[model samples]
Target: MTPEEKLQHLPDKPGVYLFRDTAGEIIYVGKAVSLKNRVRSYYQSGSRLSPKVRALMNRAADFEYIVTDNEVEALILESNLIKEHRPRYNIYLKDDKSYPYLRVTLGEDFPRVHVTRRVVKDGSRYFGPYTSAGAVHETLDLLRRLFPFRTCKQKLAEGVMSARHRPCLNFHIGRCLAPCSGQVGREEYRAMIREICLFLEGRQDDLVKELTRRMNEAADKLEFERAARLRDQLQAVRQVLENQKVLSTSKEDRDVVALAQNHDLSLVMIFFVRGGKLIGRDQFLVLGAENTPEEVLTAFVKQYYVRADFIPGEILLAEMDPQERPAIEEWLSGIRGARVRLVVPRRGEKKQLVDLAAKNALLALQEVEQEQKSRGQGRDACAELARELGLENIPYRIECFDISNTQGEESVASMVVFEEGRPAPGQYRRFKIRTVSGPNDFASLKEVLTRRFTRAREERELIQTGQLSTRQAKFYQLPNLVIVDGGKGQLSAVRKVMKELGFAHIPAFGLAKEEELLFAEGRSEPIRLPRDSRALHLLQHLRDEAHRFAVTYHRQLRTRRNLKSLLDEIEGIGPVRRRALLKAFPSLEEMARATVEELAAVPGMNRAAALAVYRFLRG
Candidate 1:
C-alpha cells in the first residue's frame, strides 16, 4: 500500500513502525503507544515536525510496522531493530566495542567460569557487563584463589571425566580441583559455584556468613583441612568488603546517570551502585545528539539497558521528561522481571550522586575537546602538505599503500587510513597478491590499486542510484590523497592505474624511505621538507604504519604455511589431527616441548598420534 493508505489503516495499539525509502531500505524506526495516532501525526500537514523528521519523510516512499503485545515489548523490539539495521535517521550508539562479562557454564556437568565478550542464548549465567577488562581479570584471579574450580576447556562430562588418568598443571599448582580427572565430586564443585555466584553478585555479607557456617561445620566434624580452607575464603571476602565504600544505609541497587553536551557531541557518565556501595562507573561519548537533554537521556536509557546483564531497581537521571518517565520505567521493569523506578531527584543523597556524575561528565567532555584540539594540529599539517604539493583539496582522509614479500612467497599488500589526522584502524585493510608472480612489487601494487578503485567506482554508482545503503558502502568512498611507499617508480605505477580507471584527478605522491623525500607525479625533482616539519612527520608515520601492517600479515601467512608443511610430513596425521595439534599448541617451539600425555589430552588426538607429533617436532 501507499504511505497515506498505510497510515489510514494503522492499528491503535503499541507497536514499532518502520519508514522505508524507495529502495525498501529501512531509514527510521520508532516505538509508539498508540500507533494509529502516532503514525498519523507524521502525515498531518498542519502539524510542525523537526527538520530531521521532515528530511526523513521526504525520502520515505513506503512504511511497515509490527504489532507487539504491549508498549514494553514494542520498546524492546524497537531497540533491537535499530541496533541491527542502524537506520540513518535514528540516534545510533556509534561505539563498536563490546564490554566483557563473566560467564558461568551452568549447563555442563562440571561447570566452568571464564571471561567472554559475547552473550549467547546457551543456558549460561552471565554476571557482568564490566567496562574494564583489567577489573574482570582481577576478579577472576581473586576467584581462582578463593575457589579451586577447573579452568580448562575439556569436555568434563561424567563419561569423559572418568576416562582421564592424569591431571594437568593446574592441579599440581593447587589452582584447579581437576574435575577432568574426577578429583572433585559434583556436589563439591556445585558448592564452589554457588559461592562464586554470590561473590560476583556483590553479596559479600551473605558469602562471608555462608563460608563461616561451612567452616564451623567442618570444625565440628574434625575436618581441620577443610575448616582452614573455608576460613581463608571467609577472610578474603571480608577484606574485599572492607575496601568497598558504602554510599547509603539501605541495601538498594541503583544507577546514577548524567550528561554533558557541547554543540553536537555529548558525554554520558553512569555510576553503578550495588548493595548501597559504589562499585564502578562507565563513560560514553555520543555524537550527533542534536536534541534536548531530556530527549538524549530518554534515548540513552532505552538503548543502554538492552545490553546490560543486570538492571537496577532504580535509575537516577539528571533530567527526564515527566511524560516519558513512566514508559521508561515500564520498559526497564519488563526487562528486569521486577519493578523499576525512574527518578529525577530534586534533593537528597541521590541528587548529590547525580550532581557528582554530572561533574564527571563535564570533565570527560573537556578531555575530549582537548584531544580534538590536538587532532586539529594534524588537520593543519594536512593543509600545509596540500599547499606544499599544490593540490586542490586538503587531505583530510589519506590512504597509504605498501607491499611486502620474500622472493614472491606469500605476497601481501596493506591499506591504512587516516581521518582528520588520526589513524583509523577500523578502516585498515590487507590484500593477498593474486595476479602477480615472483617478487614483482610494481605489478602487485598495480593489481591492488586496480581492484580497490574498480570496487570504489561500482559502489559509488550503486549509492547514487539508491540501490545500496550508505552504511554498506562506507569503505568504498575515494580518499582525498594517496601515498605509496616507494619513490618515483611506485608513483608512476599508481598514476598509470588511476588514469586507466578514469580517476586521474585524485592527487597522488610517493615517499622514499632512505632520504625521506616526497615524489609527486610529473615532478622532475624530489621535494625535501625540514626535519621538524609536521607535514613530513605525518607522511613518515603513515608510511611506517603501512609497512608494519604489511609485514605482520606476511609473517602470519608464512608461519601458517610452514606449520602445514611440517604437519603434512608426519605419517598418519591427517587434516583433522593437524588442526587439533595447531589449536592445542600455538607455535612449533611449544609443540616440540609438549609432553606425550599433554598432547594426547587434546580432542581427536590418540596416544599413538601424540607420540608421532612429538617425535616429528623433536626431530
Candidate 2:
C-alpha cells in the first residue's frame, strides 16, 4: 500500500509505526499514544518538522504500523525495533556492543563465577555491563584473592567427590576450597558463594556484617584457621568499602544519568550506585544529536536500559518529558519486575550527583572535541577524494590491504582502517599467510583480500543468526572503499576476489609507489592528483601505515619461527611443547632468562622437562 493509504488506515490505538524508503528499508521507527495521529503529524502542513525529519520524509515511500494493547507496550516495542534495525533517522546508543558481565552459575550444584560477554537464560545471575575488560579482570582478581572459590570445571556430586583422589593445585594455594576434595561441606561452599554474590552486587555493608558473623561463629567453635581466613577477607572488604564514596544514606540502588552536548556531539555519563556507595561510572558518546536535551536523554535512557540486564528500581535523571515519563517508567518497571521511578531531582544530594555527572560528561566531550580537532575532520577530504575518483558515495570508512614478506618466508598481511579520515587502530587486523607460498604479491593479495571479505560475510551471517555479536566479530564492518598497495595486477587480483565474494559494488583502487598514481577498476587511465592534494596525502598515509604494520607482524613471525627451530633441537621438546614454550616466553632471550621453576609452571611441562629446557638454553 502507498504511504498515504497506510497513514489513513493507521489505528487509533497506541502502537509503533515504521517508515520505509523505496528500497523497503526502515528509515525511521517511532511509537505514539495514537498511531494515526502521530504518523500523520509528519505529513501535516506547516508542522515545522526538523531537518532530520524532513529528510526522512523526502526518502520515505511507505509506512507500516503495529497495534499494541497500550502505550507502555508500544514504547517497549519501539525500543526493540530501533535496536534491531538501527534506522538512520532515529537517535541511537553508540557502541551498542555486548559488554562483559560477571556471571554466577546458580544452576550448578556448586556455583562458580566467571566473566562472559553473552547473557543467556540459564538460571545464572549476571551483574554488569562493565565498560572495560581490564576493570572486569581486576574485579575478578580481587574476588579470587579475597574469596577461595573454585575455578575448575570439576563435577562434585555425592559419588564423584569420593572417587577423586585429590583436588587441583588451587586447593593447596588456598585459592579454592576444592569441594571435590570431599573435605569442605556443600553448605560451607554455598555460604562462600553467597558472600561473593553480595560482594559483586556492591552490598559491601551487608557482606561485612555477614563476614563478621561467620568469623565469630568460627572463633566460637575454636576453628582458628577458618576464622583467620574470614578475618583477612573482612579486612580487605572493609578497605574496599572505605575507598568507595558514600553517595547516599538511603541504601537504595539507582542509576544517575546526565547528558552534555556541544554542536553535533553529545556525551551521556552514568554513575552506578548500590547500597548507597558509588561503584562505577560509564560514559557514552552520541554523535549527530539534533534533538533537545530532554529528548536525547529520553532516547538514551530507552536505548541503554533496553539491553541492560539489571534495571534499578529508581533512575535519577536531570530532565524528562512529563508525557513520556509514565510509559517509560512502566516499561522499565516491567523489565525489573517491580515499580520503577523516573526522578527529576529539583534540589538534594541526588540532584548534586546529576550535576556532577553532567560536569563529567562536559569534560569528556571537551577532550573528545579536542582529539577530533587534532585529527582533522576528514569529511571534506573524503568528499573531495570521492569526487576526484568519480565515485557515487563518500568513503566514510576506508580499509586498505597490504602484504609483507621476506622471500615468502613469514608472509603476512595487514588491514588498516580509517573512519571519517581518522585512523581507527582498534579495527586494524593482521592475517597470517596460510594458502600460497613465495613472494607472490598478486596471489598473496588475492588470498588476504579473499579472506578479508569472506570473513566479513561469515561474521555478518553469524551476527544475523544470533550466533555471534557485532563486537566479537573482528571482520564484520565492511569498508566503503578498498585500497591495494600495488598497481594494476594487485587491483585486478583484489577485484576478482571481491566479485567472487559478492562485494563487487565496493570500489577498489591500487596505489603505485613509483608514480603515486591510483589505478581504478574499468578505467584504462590512472588517476593522478596534485602533489599537495589532501586526498592524495590521505591515501599515502594509509598505504604507509599498512606497510609498516604488515612488516612489523612479519618480523615477529620470523622471530617466532627461529625460536621454535632452536627449541626443537632440544631432545624432549616437540612441536606442541615448543609452541607452548614460545607462547609462554615470546622470545628465546626471554626463555633463556626464565628459571626452571618458571618454565615448569607452564602447562604441559614438568620439572624434568623444565630442567632440560633450562640447561639447553644455558648450555
Candidate 3:
C-alpha cells in the first residue's frame, strides 16, 4: 500500500512507525502515543518538520508500523528496533567498541564469574556496563584476589566432581575453591557467591561488617585458618573502598549524564556513582548528531540503558524533553525491577555533578575533533586518488579483501573497511571459503566476492521493499572502492563477480605485494606511485590490514583444527572430554605439558582418561 493509504488506516494506539525510502530501506524509525496522528503529521504540508525529518520524508516512499499495548511498550519496542535497524534518521550510538559487563552464571550449580561483552538472558546476573574493558579486568582481578571463586567453565555436577581425584592449580594457588572436585560444599561456595554479589553491588560497608562477624565467629570456634582468611578479605575490601571517592552525602546511587555537541559530532559523558561514592566514568562519541540536546539525551538514555547491566536509583540527565521524562522513567524502572527516577536537577550538588559531566564531555569532544583534523590528510589523499583514477565519487568508504590459506587448508577471506581514511574495525568481516575446494586464489576471490555482494544485494532489496527493518549488512551500501590483495588476475576475478552481481560501478583495483604496483579494472599497464605518496601509503595500509586480518583468522582456525586432531589421536578422549581439555588448556603446548593430576582435574575426565591423554602427549 502507498504511504498515504497506510497513514489513513493507522491505528490511534501507541506504536512504532517505520519510514522506508523508494529502495524499501527503512531510513527512519519513530515511536508515538497515537500512530495515526504521529504518522499523518509527517505528511501534512503545514507541519514544521526539522530539516532531517523533511529530508527523510521526501525519500520515504512507503511506511510500516507495529502496534504496542501502551506508550511504555511502544517506547521499549522503539529502542530495540532502532538498535536493530540503526535507521539513518535516528540518533544512535556508533562507537566501535562494546562495553563489558561482569557476568555471574547464577544458573550453574556452582556459579562462575567472568567478564563478557555480550549479555544473554540465561538466569545470569550481570553488573556494571563498564565503560572500558581495562576497568572490567581490573575489577575482576581485584575480586579474584579478594574472593577466590572458581573461574573454570567446567560442569560442577555431583557425578562429574566424583570422577575427579584432585583439584586444579587454581585451588592450590588459593584462587579457587575447587568446586569441580567436590572440595568445597555448596553452602560454603554459595556464601562466597553472596559476598561477591554484595561486593559488586558496592555494599562495601555491609560486606565488610559481615566478613568481620564471620571472622569473629570463626575465631570463637577455634577455626584460626578460616578466621585469618576472612580477616585478609576484610582488609582488601577496605582498601578498595578507600580508593572510591565519596561524591554525595545522601548515599543515593545515581548516574550523571551530560553531552557536548557540534553540528556533526557529539560526546556524551556518564559518571557512575554507587553508594554515595564515584566509582567510574565513561565517554562516548556519537557521529552525525544534528539533533537537539534534549533529543540526543533522550536517544542516548534509551540506547545506553538497554545494554546496561545495572540501572541506578536515579538518572540525572543534562537535558531531556519534559514529555519524555515519565515514559523513560517507567521504562527504566521496569528494566531495573525497582522505581528509578529520571531527573534534571536544576540546583545544588546534583546540578554541579551534571555540570562536571558536561565539562568532561566538552573536553573529550575537543580531543576527538583534533584527532579527526589530523586524519583529514588521509581523507585528502583518498580524494586525490579519486581524481587521479577519474572515479565518480571520492572513495570515502573503501573495502579491501585478501585470501589466506596454508596449502589449501583452512582457507579464509578477510574484508576490512576504511571510512574517511580511518579504519572502521566494526565493519571488518571474515569469510571461510566454502565453494572452492583448494588454494585457487582466483576462484576463491570470486566465491568470496559473490557471497559478499549477493548478500548485500539481497539486503538492499529487502530494505527497499520494507521487508527487513534492521541489517548489519556491511555490504548493503557498496564501498566506493574495492582493493584485492593480488595482481591483475585477482582484480579480474573480483571484477567479473562485481559485474555479474550488478556492482561494477564500484571501482576495484589490486595492489601486487612485491612490486607495490596498482592494477586498475581496465588498465593493462600498472600505475606506480612514488614510494612516499600518500595515496600509495593509504592503499598499502588497507592491503596490509586485510592481509593481517585474514592471516589472523587463518591461524585461529588452524590452531583449533590442530588441537582437535591432537585430541582425537588420544584414546578415550571423546568430544566431551576433548572439549573440556581444550577449554582448560586452549593451546596444545599447555595440554602437552600438563600432568596427569592437572588433566584429571578437568570436569568429566577421570584419572584413567587423563592418564591416557597425558601418556599419548608425552609419547
Candidate 4:
C-alpha cells in the first residue's frame, strides 16, 4: 500500500505499527500514542528522517497496526511484538533468556519461592527483574538461610504438599523451615512469610527487632532449640543487610545513566536500583556512532532503556538531553507503576554515581577507539594494495590460499583471512587438498578455490533470505581481492575455479616469492609495488601471514606424526591412549609430565595404565 492510503486507514489511538520490507518481512516495529499521526509523520512536509530510515521506507512494502486501550497497553504490546518478531530496525534486548523476577507464589495453601524470567500480572508478589544470575542466586541463598525457603528443584517441582519422608540436608543445615514434612504448623509458616515480605520490602531492621523479641519469648518459654535457630538466622540477615550498604542508603528507586563516545562508537551504562538497594546494571556499546557527546548521550538513553526490564522513579544521566528528555520522560512515566523523573545533577551523591558509570563507559570506548585506530593504518595500506593491483576497491578483508605438504604426502590447503589488513586468526581455515594426487599447486589451488567460492555462493543466497549459515559467513563473503603465493599459472588456476563456481567477478592475483612480484588474471607481465609504499607493505604482510599459516599447519602435522611415533615406541601406550592424552591437553609440551591422577582421567587409561605411562615418560 502507498503511504497516503495507509495513513488514511490508521486510527488516532495508541498502538504498535509494523514496517514490512519488499520481501514482506517485518523490518521495523514501533509504538505510538496516536497511530495515525505517528505513521503519517513519515510522509509529512518538512519532516526528514535519518538516511537509514529513508532506506527502510523505500523498501517498505506495506504497514500494519494493532490499536490499544491506552498508551501503557501500547507500550507493553510493542515490547511483546518486538520480542516475538525481532524486527531488524528495533533496538533489541538480544539475550534469549527472559528478564528474571523473584516470585513469591502465595496462591497455593503452601507458598513457594521461585526465580522466574517473566513478570506476569498474577496475584503473586514479584520483587525484581534482576540483571545478574549471580545476584539472584545470592538472594535465594540469603532467603533460604533466613526464612527456611525450599531450595531443592525436585521438591519444588513435586510440590511438597503433604511433607517430605525425612528432613533433607537443608533442614539439618538450618536453611529450611522443614514444613514440607509437617514439622512446622501453618500459623508459624504464615508469620515467617510476613517477616520475609517485610525484609524484601526494605524493612529489615524492624523485622530483625521483631524476630529478636520472638526469640526472647521462646527462650522464656524454655524452647531453647527454637530460640537458638532464630538467633542464627537473625545474625545472618543482619550481616547481609550490612554488606549491601556500600552502594546506597536511600532505599528509593533510581537508575544511574552514563555515556561515552569514540570516533565511531559509543557506550552507555545503566545501574538499576529499587528500595534504595542496587539490583542490577546493564552496559550497552553501540557501533558506528560518531564522537559527539550530546548526540551519544541522547542515543544511548533512547536506544538502551526503551525496553528496560524495570523503570525507576528517577533516571540519573551523566549528561543532559534537552530535546529528547521530554518525550522520553513521557514514554517512561506511562510504563512505570508510578511517576518517573529524569535528572542531570550538577553536584551531589547521585551525580557521583553517574560520574563513575560515565568513567567506566569512557574507558570501554577508549579501548575500542584504540583498536579502530590501529586497524585504520592497516586498512589504508590495503587501499594502496588495491591501487597497486588495479582493482575496484580497498582490500579491507582479503583471503589468501596456499598449498602445503611434502611431495603430496599428507597434502593440505590453507586459507587465511585478513580483516582491515590484520590477520583474523580465528577465521584461518585448513582443507585436505582433495581431488589432487601429486604436488601440483595448480590443481590444489583449483580445488581450494572451488570449495571456497561454491560455499560463498550458497551463503550469499542464505544471507539474502535472512538465514546466515554460521560464524564462518564473513570468511566466505567475496573478499575485495584475492591473493595466492605463486606466479601467473597459479593465478590462472584460481581464475578457472572462480569461473567454474560462476564467480568470475571476484579478482584473483598472485605474489611470487622469488621476484616479489604480483600477477593478476589475463596479465602476462607482473606488477610490483613501490619499495617504500605503505600499500606494498600491507600486501607483503598479507602474503607473509598466508605463508606463515600454511607452513604452521604443515609443521603441526609433522609434530603430531612425531609425537605419535614416540608413543608407538612405548609398549603400554596405543592409539586409544594416545588420542585420549592428546585430546585431554592442548599440546605434548603440557602433557609431557602429567601426574598419575591427571593421566587416569584420560579415557582407556586407568590407575595402573596411567602410572605405567607416567613412569615411561619420566624415564
Candidate 5:
C-alpha cells in the first residue's frame, strides 16, 4: 500500500512508529499515545514543528507501527527500538564507553570476584556502571584486601575433597580462600562473596553489623586468628560507611536527575541515592535533543533506565511532562518488581538535590563544550576538507585505512574513523591480512577495503531484510569520506574495490606522508595543501593513528609467534603447557623472572615441567 494510505489505516492505539527513507532504513523511531493522531500530525500541512522533526519529515518516505497493550509497553518498545536502530533523526545518549562493573560468577561452584566492562547473563551478578575505570579498580583492590575470594582462572572440581591442584601464593598470603585446593568449603567462600556483594550494593551498615557479630562469636570461641580477621574487616567496613555521604535521613532509595543544554548539546546528570546515602553519580551527553527540556528529559530517562541494572524506588526529576510521569513510573516499577514514583519536588530537600544535580550538569556541559572546542571538532574542518577536495558533499564521518608489516611477516591492516572531526576509537577495527601473502601494500589495501565494504553491503542487506538490527551491523554505517595511507597506488586500489562494491559514489582519497600530498580518483595531479591547513592536519592525524594501530597489531602477532616458537623448543612443554605459561605470564620477560615454585603454581604445570620452563627461559 502507498505510505499515505497506510498512514490513514494506522490504528488509534498506543504503539511505536518507525519511519524509513527510500533505502528501507529506519531514520526515526517514536512512541505515541494515539498512533493515528501522532503519526498523522507529521503529514498535516502548515503544522508547526521543530527543525529536527521537519528535517525528518523531508527524508521519511514510509513508516511501520507496532501496537502495544498500553502506553507503558509502548514506551519500553520505543526505547528498545531507538537503542537498536539508533535512527538518524532520534536523540542519542552519546555514551560510547562501556562502564566497568564488578561481576561475581555465581553459577560456578566457587565464585570469583573481578572487574569487567562487559555485562552478560552467564549466571553472574553485576554491580555498578562505575563512572571511571580507575575508581572501579581501586574499589576492586579494596574488596580483595577486605574479603578472601579467589581471582585465579584455574578450573576447580566441585565438591571434590581430593583435588590434584596445589594452592598458589595468594592462598599463603591470605589474599584468597584457595577454593581450588578443595580445602576451603564452598559455602564458607560463598558467604564471604555474599558479604562483598552487600558492600558493593551499599549495604555497609548491615555488613558492619554482621561482621561485628561474627567477630564476637569467633573471639568467644577462642579462634584468635579468625577473630582478628573479622575484627579488621569490621573496622574497615565501618570506616567505609563513615566516609559515604548520607544524602537523606529517610533511609529511602532514589535518584535525583537534572539536565543542562547548550543549543543542541545537552548533559543529563543523575545522583544515585541508595539507603538515603549518595552511592554514585553519572552523567550522559544527549545528541539531537528536542526543542523542549521536558522531551529531552523523558528521552534521556527512557534511554538510560532501560539498560540500567538497578532502578531506585523513586526518581526525582528537575522537569518532566505531567502526562509522561505515570507511564515512566509504571515502566520502572515493572522492571524493579515494586512500585516506583516520579517526583517533582517544588520545595524541600529533594528540590535542593535536584538543583545541585542541575548545577553539576551545567558544569559538565560547559566542560564538554570546551573540550570539543579545543579539539577543533566544533570548527570547519569538514568544510575545509570539502573545499580542498572540490567535493560535492561535506564529510561528516571520515574513515582512514593503513597497512603494516615487517618483511612480509604478520601482515595487518587497520581502519580508523573520525566523526565530526573527532577520533572515534570505539569504531576502529583491525584485520589480519588474510589473502595477501607478502609485503604487498597495494594488494593488502585492496583486500582490507574489499572486506570492509563487502561486509557493509551484507550488513545493510540484512538490516533491510529484518534479519539484523542496525547496531548489530558493525560495518553497515558507511563513512562519508574514505582515506588510505599511500600515494596513487592505494587510491587506485580503493577506487577499484568501491566500483566493484557499488559504492563508487562515495569519495575516497590517498594520503602520502612525504610532502603531505593527497591523491583522489581520476586525478593525475596530486592535491597539495598548506602544511598548516586544518583539513590536512586532520588527515595526517588519522593516517598516523591508523599506522600506529596497524603496527601495534603486527608487533603483537609477531611477539606471539616468537613466544610460541621459543616455548616449542622446551623439552616438557606442549601446546597446552605453552598456552598455560603464556596465559600466566603474557611476556617472556615476566616468565623468566618467575621462580621455579612460581612457575609450578601455574595450572597444569608440574614441578619437572616448571623447572624445564624456568631453565629454558633462562638459557
Candidate 6:
C-alpha cells in the first residue's frame, strides 16, 4: 500500500494506530481522540516529525488500527499495546517491570491482603500504583502489623479453605492474623480488615478508635497477650502516619506537576498529595524535548493521567494549558467517579502545592543545567578534536558505542546519544552483538554502528522522498557526531567501517580510557578540557551514559548467567525451572539466603530439588 493511501484509510473515529514496515514489523504506535484528523496532521506543514521519519515513509508499506469504545479506552489500549509490541517510535517509560500495589480483596471470605502489580475489576480494592516499590511494601508491612489479615494466596484459591495448620513465619513475626490456622476468628479478621480499610481511606481517628476498643475488649476479657499485641500494632500504624507530613487538608486528593526546560533537556517534578498528606515527591529528566516547559507539562499530564486508572480529585498546575484543561478534567472525572477539578491555583494551600512542585521542577532543571555545563566542556573538546580531524560541523549530537561482555558470554553493544548538551535516553539504542562470537568489543561495536547508520540512511531517503511519517522519529532524527568510548584504536576501527560504507561527512572521535584523554587524527598528544566546560561535559555525559547502559545490560546478563549456573546443580532444573527460580528468587545471593523450605515453596521447586539447592549452597 502507498503511504498516502494508508493515511487516507485511517478511521475518523477515536482509537489507536500502528505503522508497519514492508516486512510487517511495527515501527510506531500512537493514539488519537479523532484518528483520521490526527493521522492526517503528519502531512501538514510545520509538523514535528523528524527528518528520519520523512525518509522512512517509503518503507511503511501498510497501516493498522483498533477502534476503541472511547478515547479513554483508546488511551489505555494504546499503553498496553505499546508495552506489548514495544514499537520503536513510542516514548517508553523505560522501566516496565511491574511494581507492587496494595490489594485488599474485600469479596473473599478471609479477605486476603497482599501486594500485587496488576489491577483488574475482580471485586478487590487497590490503593496505588506507587512510584516507589519499597514504600509500597513498607506500607503493606505496616498494615499487616496493624491488622493481621490473611496473606495466604492458597486460602484465596481454595475459596477460603481455613485449615487450622501451623501459622507461617509471618504470624510469628507479628505480621499476620494466622487466619489460615484459625488463630484469628472470622469475625475478628473482618473487624481488623475494616480498621485497615478505614486507615487506608484516611480515617485515622476511626481506625484508632476501633483499635482502642479492641484493645480494651481483649484486656477486659483477660486476654492480656492479645491486648499487648494490639497495643504494639496500633502504635506502629500511628507512628508511621504521624511521620507523613500534610501538604493540604482541603479534603481533596491531588497532584501538582510542573516542568522546566533549558537548552536541550527538560525537568518534570510531581508532587503527590493523598487525603491531604504529602506522601512523597519524584522528578524526571526528559532529554531531547524541543518543547517549552508548559508545552511539555501539558502533554505529560494528558498522556500520563489518561493512561492511569487512579485519578486525583483535583490537579493544581503552575502553568495552564487552556485548550487541554477541559478534556483532561472531563476525562479524570469519569475515572474518579466524581467531579474532578483542574485548576491553576493562584492563592492559598492549592497555590502552595503548585509552588512546591514548581520549586522541585526548578531544582531538577538546575541539576540538568549543571550536568549540561559539564557536558558542554566535553562537547567543545570533541568539536576541537573533530576540527583537528578535519570534520564539518561542531558535532552537537554525539553518539557513543560501547561493548560489554563477560569472557564472550552475553555480548551486547549500547549506543548512547548526546544531543546539544545532555544524554538523550529516548535516542539510546542497544544491539545484541549478533555477528561476534565471544567478547570482541571492536567487532560488536562495528556491527552495531554499521547496522544503525545503514538503517538511518534508508530512513533518511524515505523521509526526503516525502514518504515517511513524523510518528516514526518525533525526537530521534540522526546524530551529527559519533564517539566510540575507546582510544585511537577504536577510532581507527570506526573510520575504516565508515569509509567502507561510503559515509564520510559525519564526524567521529574517541576518548581514551587511561588518563581520561581525548584522541583525534593528526593530534600527536591527547587533549583535555576544563572540568566545568559544558560541551566537554556533554561528551563525558554521553560516554558515561553509554558505559552505564552497557554495564547495566552486562550485569543483567551476568546475573542471569550466574542464576542458571546455580540452578544447573539441581536435579530437576531445566531452562523453565531455572527461569522460574530466578524470577522468584532474583539472585544467587538471595537463593543462598532462602531456607530449604522457602525454596520448596517456589512453584517448580519440590522437596528434593530444594534439598539439592540447599546442599549446593552449603558446599
Instruction: Tell me the whole-model lDDT of each prediction, alpha carbons only.
Output: 0.85, 0.87, 0.86, 0.73, 0.86, 0.72
What is the clash count for each candidate, in the order shown?
0, 0, 6, 4, 0, 25
**lDDT tens per residue, model 2, 1-619:** 6777776677889999998899999988999999888888899664698866777888988888899999998998998898889888888867666578889888877888999988889999887777668878888998999899988876666445763555554665568887876768778888999999888766777899999999999999999999998998899888888888988888899999999998766888999899888987888776544777888888988888887767788999987888899999988888889999999999988899899989988998888788878566587778888999988999989999999999988999999999888789999999998999899999999889888888999999999999999878999998999999999999999999999989999999999988999999888999998899889988998999999999999999999989888888888888788877887799888899988877876667778999999999899
Work out how many backbone clashes candidate 4 has. Answer: 4
Across 56-127, the per-residue lDDT of candidate 6 in tens digits comes to 454566677889887767766775676688765444433434645678898776787778878789998877
Candidates in descending TM-score order? 2, 1, 5, 3, 4, 6
For residues 421-526, write the lDDT of model 3, one tens digit per residue.
8899989999999988878999999999999999898998888889875454566877999999999999999999999999998899988999999899768789
Off by over 4 Å in 1: 1-12, 43-48, 51-69, 96-99, 128-148, 162-166, 172-174, 287-289, 368-527, 539-619
**Model 4 Cα lDDT, one tens digit per residue, 104-141:** 87654446777887766776777755555667778776
lDDT, residue 540, candidate 4: 79
The 10-residue segment of model 4 with minimum total lDDT is 152-161
lDDT of 5: 0.86
TM-score of 4: 0.57
Given candidate 4, what's the lDDT at residue 147?
A: 86
Candidate with better TM-score, 4 vs 6: 4
- Extract clashing residue pairs from model 4: 163-180, 251-275, 251-276, 252-276
Error of 2 at 312 (Å): 5.4
Q: Model 6: which ten-residue window has the lowest total lDDT? A: 88-97
Estimate candidate 6's RMSD in Å: 13.1
Off by over 4 Å in 5: 95-97, 161-166, 289-291, 377-619
Q: How does residue 393 of candidate 4 score in lDDT?
A: 74
TM-score to true structure, per model = 0.65, 0.68, 0.64, 0.57, 0.64, 0.50
Off by over 4 Å in 4: 1-71, 77-255, 261-266, 271-315, 319-345, 366-384, 392-397, 404-411, 419-422, 433-447, 450-476, 496-505
Tell me model 6's lDDT, rounded to 2 decimals.
0.72
